[model samples]
Target chain A: MTKKQIQEKIAFTVLTMTMFMVVIPTLLIIGYIIYKGIGTISWEFITAMPRKGMREGGILPAIVGTIYLVMGTIILALPLGVGSAIYLTEYAKQGKVTRLIRLAIMNLAGVPSVVYGLFGLGLFVYFLNIGTSILAGALTLACLILPVVITASEEALKSVPQSYREASLALGATKLQTIQKVVLPFAMPGILTGAILGIGRAAGETAPILLTVAAFFLPRLPKSIFDQAMALPYHLYIISTQVPNMPQGIQYGTALTLLGLVSIFFMLATVIRIKFKMANRA
Target chain B: MSKISVKDLNLFYGDFQALKNITLNIEEKKVTALIGPSGCGKSTFLRSLNRMNDLIDGVKIKGDLKLEEQDIYQKDVDVVALRRRVGMVFQKPNPFPKSIYENVAYGPRRYGIKTRKQLDEIVEKSLKKAALWEEVKDRLSKSALGLSGGQQQRLCIARALAMEPEVLLMDEPTSALDPIATAKIEELIVELKKEYTIVIVTHSMQQAARISDETAFFLMGEVVEVDTTQKIFTKPRDKRTEDYVTGRFG
Candidate 1:
């Protein structure tokens, strides 16, 4: 073989090996959890309330609580994040102020989730007098995912062709009207993708929920936004570490369930993104 | 009577001047063409007629511009209303990623034409006026992006026509089209002048001679000459206009 061909083959093999190093561990972890947890999963385990300190029965309350928190987080974050993105992309002039705002969003994304938990505890839980409830936890998760949503939404808005805006404006449409009729529709798929990704991240997050809303062993479903609830991630963490004599089967089962929940969110986002793409193409 | 008039107009992009002191009057229901080399301010002049230049940041305009004796540059001038009366077609075809019917209906819809019957009428009339109705009549519901480049350009014209503007601005509208499409657009321009005042910017001198009744030649951010298209093309005038028309230099 030629020297160049041999070098190209070596480079390709090295890249393949590097990719497998990342992929193998993820597959192994998921496979192990599914294998260990499959035995514990049953109709009763999913539907029945927890019994004997979460060691004997189901995680229905935790499942319900996670759903509530996700919905609340999406409600609080989607509008704020998308609005901020629109302002930055369309309305804000390119100057020092815009640059500063962009920098602040980037920094917010970098801050640790644990820091967000403390901020939520102090702000939403205590100062606001909302206490430890679904509202506080969802607010914290919303803050944690705000940067993701804003960045993704801004990217989506920026992807729209400048010509579309010009065409709308030239037709005598007002700036707001142009955005509503032309810009937003073109950017919808991207905006929804960002929101779905944010929800997925919020669903799997434990740190922000821990200090803000999660209860130690709440077996009852949350009755309202003001009530305390049990989330999948926090419940998994508690059973795996905090609870003594916790069965390996139960720990694996909780971890698998949390992973499955997050996977479901990811799959839903993918489906929605595909639907939008198909519509756009048509 | 003049449909639009400009006097001693100057435009600046920060420190760089894009248009120098210019004065001209555009006759009503006539085809007036602006011919120039690239960056000679012909397109800029066309955009200024409809105040499309205001979209750019750091753009500054000085002096008087009037549309039908109304001072368009005044603070109280309703830009949206002004734009509604002076519609513009871009150099390249830019049909919205929507059905052909929706693309043509977009302008009327913005003005609160909500009923489907009214929109259908406007869309049909506009498309027919643009010479694209027959080609797309059966597929009004199809995506406009699926059409060929020439069809798309005509669709854009139909979209602008739906606004029912008094003046139409074309900025090198045929530069991106093939000869056949270019001929079709030139024909459309000639036919359109009976109803609406038309100001078109063209890089092709032959196109200006063929389609416009009055022609203005721009050079280095200034209008060198304005006259009947025949006189500009045939007779001796400014040395620059003569050289530019003869293809001596840009």
Candidate 2:
């Protein structure tokens, strides 16, 4: 019909095609994994210890290890990330130095996870003598996720209206008090979302933990920070590629378990985001 | 008697001067309104009272600004204490994203009032002072963002009053409200003058005539005239003041 209508139709079609291209692959992968692995997931599979040269029984230690790693990473990253974000957004003068620091953080986020693994190997494993343990792995993952946390937190901090700060300051609150009582609370939900996303990334990471932790055949759970642990991603990697003649059900189950763990983190973040949005509205 | 005094006050934002040679004395328990065209530095002058201007980088102030015989611009002056003594309400309503009670209680809490009973009393008293107590008394624990624009503005006033400041600086407090809301705030301002000295910046000339005890017309960063609202409105001294009053020009 009309030329304008034809052009609009073409543009809409192109956008829909691009959206499908992105959505299809993600759904395909997740759907395939669920189809292949759903039968393998069970209460025993989630809670039982591995046996028969990692070909039988369950992946209880790996699940527990991932939980520990995620917790440690959050403990290390959240405060440091939020603090740096506050300084960058509120205290730092908008000039060359601030710009440079922002650029460095962006670059840090782009660096390969393998490079982080090597750094962890050298620093946490050997130089620091913390050894291949949960502490080392968590610290390494913390480093890997620090940039994401900082950027997200900075964005959250920036999104808070300047009017709130002015109101607090004008009401006789000191700068620190205003930040603590007003600004921080307003930005808390956003900061938490960022932290949860970071935790998810840290939980799913294999390379950083591979060199720093990931005990291959450990039947017992890590009792201390110094003890080596079996993480989900690394366990999946071992079962699927390294372990000779590993059972198909076990490999799919490990993959499914890792996916489930990461999804839980993402779901948690979504729930929190929604709750905060409702609270803000109220 | 003068509660706050200024002598040849000049303010600059980087290279551009915003307020120039502004000399005025604000009396205790009086409603003094600063009226001018947009960007004539009326709002800037209001902000200068509590050193709220200090928050802006590249801002420079010269000459003397004194509150009750104390030079507020002096380096040794405790800005936090000064702000506590002189509170401010902004042009737009800015209630914190908190309960109405928490919004009012925020100031006293900062000064280390932690008990719920004390905070509750202060919140009620401040809200009553701002003429918002009866309307919001039931919803004190509810989020303040749920209130209407005018209510939110009154809530902000209540928040400022919670600090128990002697001087209240309002930067166009009702500019964002409907006519009914504006009238209510005007009534509140008149009632508030019995206790606290008030300085307000408004764009509405009719508003200044209706509420202000004294009026200062700012023109191009200078005080064109400062006198009793009646004299300034009826028998104006300067040609610019006469023209501005008679709706000749801003």
Candidate 3:
């Protein structure tokens, strides 16, 4: 074979190997969790409350807590994020101040989740005196995912063609009317996808909820926003590391359940995005 | 009678001047064509008629521009009302990603014509005026994006007409269409001018000659000449206008 052909073959093999290297680890982790936890998973394990210090019973409380946290995060974050995104994209003038604000938002997305937990603890727990409750956790998680929602929503709003805005405005529609009648409708799908992605992220996040709302041993569902709750990610962390004599199957089962919950969110985002794209095409 | 008048109008995009001292009167119920080379401020001049230029930041305008007796640049002038009076169609077709019916009805609905009967009549009349009703009448509920390029351009025209504006500003409205579509739009322009005053910016000298009663030739951010289309195309005039009309240079 020619040297060039040989070199091409080698390059292709290396690239293919690198691509699989990324996928293989992810598949192995998921496979390992399922293999270890499949025997433990049952109808009772999902429906019943904890028994014997969460060593013997189901994870219903954790599941409920996660659902509540995710819903609250979405309720609090979606409107605020989408609103800020609309202002930045449609209303804010391009200037030094706007540029700085954009830069700050971009940087806020990169701030570690643990730092967000500390901030939430200080602000919501001590300053506001909401304490380590679901309210505090949701607020913390909302802040953690706000940057994601804002950034994604900003991208979605900006993706709308400039010509659409011009057409609406040229038709004698007021600025607000143009946005309401034309811009927002086209941008709705993108904004929803961004919000769903933020929800997915909020569901999987443990650090922000760890200090703000997650209970170490509480096995009951939260009655109100002010009550402490057990969440999937923190529950998994506690069972795997903090608890003594934790069963191998139970640990992997908790991991698998957390993965399943997060996967559901991601799947929802994909479905919504695809559904809107098809609607747009048709 | 003049439907609109401009006097010593100057427009600046930040520091760069785009339209310089453009003074002209657009006659009532006539097709007036603005023909010029690229970057000759024809499109900018067209956009200024409806205050569409106000959407761009750092844009500065100095001079008196009037739609009839109303100075449209006055502090209290309602831009929305001004736009309703002077509608615009873009160079490329920009129908909303909606059903054909919805696209046509969007303007009237926005102006508080919410009753279904009124909207239906307006949409039908506007589509018929734009020469697209017979073709699209069957699929009024179909997505406008499914239409071909020419159909989309006509849809845009129908959308603008739904507002019932006194003047329609078209900026190279058929630039993105093929020969057949361009011919169709030119025919629509001739027909539309019987009721609504029409101002169009076109690169095609033949198009201006075919549809326009009056023509203004702009060059380098200024109106080089304004006259009857026949005179501009046939008779002796400024050397630059002659050169541009005869394809000497852009």
CA shift of A75, model 2, Å: 1.1
Q: How close is candidate 2 to the true structure, as a TM-score?
A: 0.97
Q: Fnat of the models, one by one?
A: 0.49, 0.67, 0.63
Model 2 steric clash pairs? none
* lDDT of candidate 3 over A112-201, digit per residue (tens): 999999999999999999999999999999998888888888888898899999999988888899988788777878888778778878
Ranking of all candidate structures by their lDDT, best first: 2, 1, 3
What is the clash count of model 3? 0
TM-score of each: 0.98, 0.97, 0.97
The sequence of per-residue lDDT tens digits that candidate 1 reaches over residues A83-146 is: 9999999999989999999999999999999999999999999999999999999999999999
Q: Candidate 3 at residue A94, lDDT?
A: 76
- Give lDDT: candidate 2, residue B125: 96
CA deviation > 4 Å runs, candidate 3: A1-7
lDDT (C-alpha, whole model) for all candidates: 0.92, 0.93, 0.91
Chain B TM-score for all candidates, comma-separated: 0.99, 0.99, 0.98
Q: Which 10 consecutive positions of candidate 2 chain A have the poorest summed lDDT?
A: A273-282
Cα lDDT tens digits for candidate 3, B20-103 = 999999999999999999999999999989988898999999999999999999999999999999989999999888899999
Lowest-sum lDDT 10-residue window in model 2 chain B? B241-250
Q: 2 or 3: which has the higher lDDT?
A: 2
Q: Cα deviation of A65 in candidate 3 (Å)?
A: 0.4
